[model samples]
Target: MVNKILISFFVRRLPEIRRSKGVTRKEIAKGVGITLGKYDKWEAGKVLPKSEDIARIASFYEMSVDEFLGLTEEESEAIKQKLIEDAERLSPEARKIVVDAMTDKQA
Candidate 1:
């Protein structure tokens, strides 16, 4: 199993990947073989995907595990255009979290 890094590593990359796939949350959930709610939690950083599941998601997005975890922003951005799309789907509360993150403000 990959040693878990900060949970944010994977969480931060989700929006980018979503942007790249041209997929909706429903489609991403379906592609990942999980429920939309669960997948949303994963993307929203409320939960972390198991190591293997992370790998699977990386593969589904045609990226490396490192890329999926936001370790490589340039490549990740190129591959994760769909991630920004999903960011819009986050709930109001979730958007606050994202906003705080953007402003370097901690909740």
Candidate 2:
């Protein structure tokens, strides 16, 4: 028989990450399909959401959880590069909008 273990790390960057992306707590709560108070708890490091919620937030930010937590700079850059490459396949107008939005958030 084989045994497997699962480990999870919770880093509270939700507040900062949401702010950096110009997203309000309410918006994140709605997007994550959770109550605002629950989201607030998650952001304040008072609690952790389900793994599904973590994945949903990462998807919303177009980043992996590790990248969202600022854990792996190089890996995060690789993810950004991949996203950029995928964005390049979009129509010029769409690409421009996405690029502009990305640029605006970083500013």
lDDT (0-100) at residue 76 of candidate 2?
53
Name the top lDDT candidate. 2
RMSD of each: 14.5, 8.9
Identify the runs in model 2 with alpha carbons over 4 angstroms from their true place.
1-12, 73-107
lDDT tens digits, residue span 1-107, model 1: 33245456556667777887787888878886779998888877778875445655766776665545655656655434443455477666554433333233111
Extract clashing residue pairs from model 1.
15-83, 16-80, 16-83, 18-82, 18-83, 19-81, 19-82, 19-83, 20-81, 20-82
Candidate lDDT values, in order: 0.61, 0.62
lDDT, candidate 2, 13-98, per-residue tens: 56668888999999988986789998877765567764446556766787755555564667656755765786677777656644
**Candidate 2's error at 78, in angstroms?**
18
* lDDT minimum window of 10 residues, candidate 1: 98-107
